[model samples]
Target: MSNKTFFSLHGGVNVIGGTKLHLTSGTDELIFDFGATYEPGKGRFDQVLTVRPGRETEDSRAAGVIPNLSYLYSPTPSKHVAVFVSHFHLDHVGMLSYLDPSVPVYLSQPSFNLLRQLEVVGEGIGTHRDLRVFPYGEWIDFGRLKVLPLPVEHDIPGATGFYVKTPEGTLAYTGDFRGHGLHPEVTTAFFARLGELGTNILVSEGTRACEAPRPDAYSESEIGTVIESAVRPGKSAFFMIYNRNIDRIATFARAARSLGRELVLTPATHHLFRTLSPEEYRLARPAVFVTQEFRVKGLPPWIAGLDVPRLTVPDIAREPARFLTELPYANLNELVDLRPDGGSCFIHSDGPPLGEFDPAFRNLKQWLRDFDLALVFARSSGHASPEYLKECVNLANPDILYPVHTANMAAMPTPAHGILAVSQLYQKYYIPGRRG
Candidate 1:
């Protein structure tokens, strides 16, 4: 009845410190996500803003995993071959470069596509990281380890949860998910099948466990309508979302079409959409192409009018504000700078609140206030809410509950299930032993 293990690295509490389950079994050292650490209170941007490797604050990763991996021998001489990234966020894949390149890294098609764009754009230090792309739902074998990529709904396209079958049992890892009631329930049906698998040890995210369930969550249609309504006859829109957010990109495309305007995409985002989308979606390429879409020359005749506003990140970073004045704008009258009557969707698809807070989203809000912009936040996070977290626990009905990806790990509500806290050094957790 003892749940105590000879060795296991339950990551520290934070959105970035992904749970790294290292069993004592032979090279069964599979890392679910090699994310980074985040410490609040510093003026440093990287620390609070993104889960970047060696970001501002103390980089436990940069110093190299000490006591955490101290249990297992350092991964120097012996390459720990199995590394799976549920998604492409910096936190999920930040440590990829740090790991021995010899170890093969696996990511879902969409995620790998997005990561590739980010790397090419010089987004972060991830470019140096090595990775191998696996189609969703495929089973990949690494020595004795068998891994399956389970698609999950997140803000990002190609987001996935993983199902791992070890000698111990079948465990499901929900990388990050939100049951947004959208897309004709395909995603929900997909995840519901996970329950049918009778997965054991359902390790899940507790990021939104502190928040109440948001009813049905934002659906693609509702979001599109809101975004469409916001963008009127003239005004241009600017959204601050990570490049990995491809599903959101699809939503934007549909929304723009609804508004009779072409959806202009950043080259970075187009890079992701081209690779992650279905083979059919590759019929036509966007103007500002990133990676080559399936050997094709045109998009579906249905979307000929649907503009693929493809502008590069370099085009923007050189002069972010200039993106407004140039491409699809510029010569357009000031009245067209934005829709008349003030309709614009100013979305902040980031957390820890990008930019500076206080003056509202740092000074970005301040800069837009004069524009007389109509802000509509039509966005949904990928993390499950507290109610959904409880619902997930009910679905799998696990022997214990271990919530990662949040500072308030202790706050997660796991009534009947045992609270398995992956305590800090010397920290004690009395999780009920798995029933033999």
Candidate 2:
């Protein structure tokens, strides 16, 4: 048997999200980030037409929703195989349920907490018995291959990058990150550590590479400022944000406080906040939005036991100006009861129905029109800007570059003194040993 290490791209390539990278050294194999893609309305399955029960893995594979690697999804256990998850984003951890539970799946502590919280809300990726938590900067060894989970700053908490040490050389994988988030120092330190380690190969995410400039790309602080400015006195303001973006949630909380309006969150968002950041939850003291559905079906034990104030549709409709609430697109029907005032507005803060491409975006627009709510955007991307990406590449100073999680591979920055090699899906590229 040869001692050469090999690498292959099984999922995220020429696309944004659904990153799966396979690395092998002899009999030991490592799979990083088993996730699904973010292309809405392009695939065979949709909201109405769902995957067949008991055949999810098979159906998804046949429809090209997931990689066609049977070994990873095999029912039988393989001791030599181990999986590493970078964060809890659905695009990065969506397919873990299909993976064999016997395989040891490793993640950060915050990622684990968030995943369990999501499970409580019926949005989890199924259960796995062998979930393990990896501490930041600690090395986990598997034969000749060792991986170090380095914390990074992304929109979601517990986002991480991996530094893999193979017999051949060292490779750095940036799962997903940004410099304009709440913590830029974390991102800076990550690249600084990569440089100190003298990494040989860089596998980076290029979500914004070659994409046209977004006018709404504000920094986290800037987003808060925009939110504050958008919410006028004597008018209700609804913010639609991704539940996992705790930083944005804090921003909304602060903005509401500054505007002297009560902050109201959906039950799911409230649960996530209390579970993930208890200290912040206590400080914010936000109210929970109690929908008619929750009243009819009875609140979950978590919501029922909460001591925080609750806001009903009638409560908000009576005094719209006193509250700044979360309005998820799924709960758009609640607008019929709330009957927002004349000057009220809806603030889209990096939530679902994200863009014109998604089918639900049309529905969101229709709802806003029907409710006569002014739509405004106050959002920031979770990924780094193109310039920041180039800066990251320069800082890492890798000998070779492999760009993933992007639609345009050609747009990725090449190392000043190294090779820019794009790995084809399922095609293995051997990593030469140091002595070879």
Candidate 3:
């Protein structure tokens, strides 16, 4: 029971999505982030096409998209593995739907609420019912290990990092964080607590820790300024952004309001906004254009109660400059009705294309060209830069460092700490020491 072992089930090297890490303290096995990968062509799964039915897990297992953790799928009860999720991102929890029903899945209260709402609205991707709301700042104890979920700032709400008091030593895992997000204090507090706890091994995400520098980057507050400066009063503005990014939406709403323009949102986007931030929703209500399509029969009570203005595509075409609307790539057909003039600006606040391999990006570029709208991009990455990562490593000062969630390990910046271990998938790293 004294020998502690660690290995990654996925996301070991040159992998982006499917991030699953396994740590064992003499049969007290714990699995963190049993998520799915986003390599569409290789894994043969994407936003449009899904795995073969009735064999989701089996086919994924065969394709190496998900690990064949036999213990999880055993028909008879053998060993119970505790599964913990850090956030609500699909890439981080996409595979949860296919997991064994017997295994317990833990998630933050906010994440649970968001998922529940999505499930109710029919946008949920088969959420597991065996979910427990994982509380922050409190440690949940197993026989030999204790896990503490700590809140961290990211693009989405309920993003968390885990602090595991293992048999070997304290291990800190930063589950996708950024200092430049809406709440810098959240990240600062996390590091402060990590410094106090004294982590021996630190597992961090290097999503943006690439050799190439992020262009036109701005802090959360500065994003509003950049957007405001980019557009004029007589021009229409359309933003292509993730609806889950509540902070970015709020910034856009505030900036649009300052410019005396209506911040028009698709019904789905408006639902997410009203559900996540009621106060911001109320504030942005006056300047928001709720689409006619949003006036459905089964409108949620909260959404129905809000006195939001319902606007049609023709309404926007009449006075395009009076609105800054949301138009995701999937809904590019709406642009035909809006008929935006050459003065319209398309602000691409989303991160760089998931690599040039993504076809959706090419389609989006073609659409923009066809519409003849000028393009502008202003965004802050959700992950810390390599230079800032070095600063975080210095601040935490862990004994061992393992960087995950990056494409190229060679281009990633190293931690200031002397010990850097490049661990392989399923290759056990023996950790020495035992928790009291």
TM-score winner = 2
TM-score of 1: 0.70
| Residue-level lDDT tens digits of model 3 in 1-436 | 4445554546535676567878777777788887766764676766677778877778777766676777676545376477888877777887776676767888899887777766655567463547888779998997678999999888888898998887667777787888887787888788778878888877777777675665686777789988888786688888877767877888888988898888887666787887788899789883334444443454555456667776767788899888888777766777877788885798888743433578767878888899988878867778777776776777777777777777765555555654666646766655532222
Q: The CA-based lDDT of model 1 is what?
A: 0.53
Output the number of the lDDT-best candidate. 2
- Model 2 lDDT tens row, 1-436: 5668988887888888889988889889888899888788665788899899999988988887776767768768654888899988888998888887777899999898898899887788866878999899889988999999999999998999999999888888899999998888899899889888988878899989897787788988799789888887888799899999887888888888888898999999999988887887887899999998887887788789878898898999999999999999989999999998766899999999899978899999999998888898998999999999888888888888888999899999888778777756777766632312
How far residue 35's Cα lies from its native spot in candidate 3, in Å, is 2.0
Using all chains and alpha carbons, the TM-scores for the candidates as numbered come to: 0.70, 0.95, 0.90
Cα displacement (angstroms), candidate 3, residue 203, comes to 1.2
Please give, for residues 1-436, the per-residue lDDT of candidate 1 as tens digits: 2323222444534543545544323554566776654434532343345445544223443343322443222345353446677776666666555554456677787666666556654664333345688887788876555778877777775677877665556666778777653442444544466567755555667776676555535654566666555554444555545546666666655554455543444454555566566442353344452212311454333233446644433433343322221121111222233332344435554433443423335445544455555544656666666666666666655555566676676767663544454434223322222431
**Candidates 1 and 2: which is better by lDDT?**
2
Question: Measured by C-alpha RMSD in angstroms, how accurate is candidate 2?
Answer: 2.1
lDDT, candidate 2, equals 0.86
The C-alpha lDDT values of all candidates are 0.53, 0.86, 0.74
Error of 2 at 106 (Å): 0.6
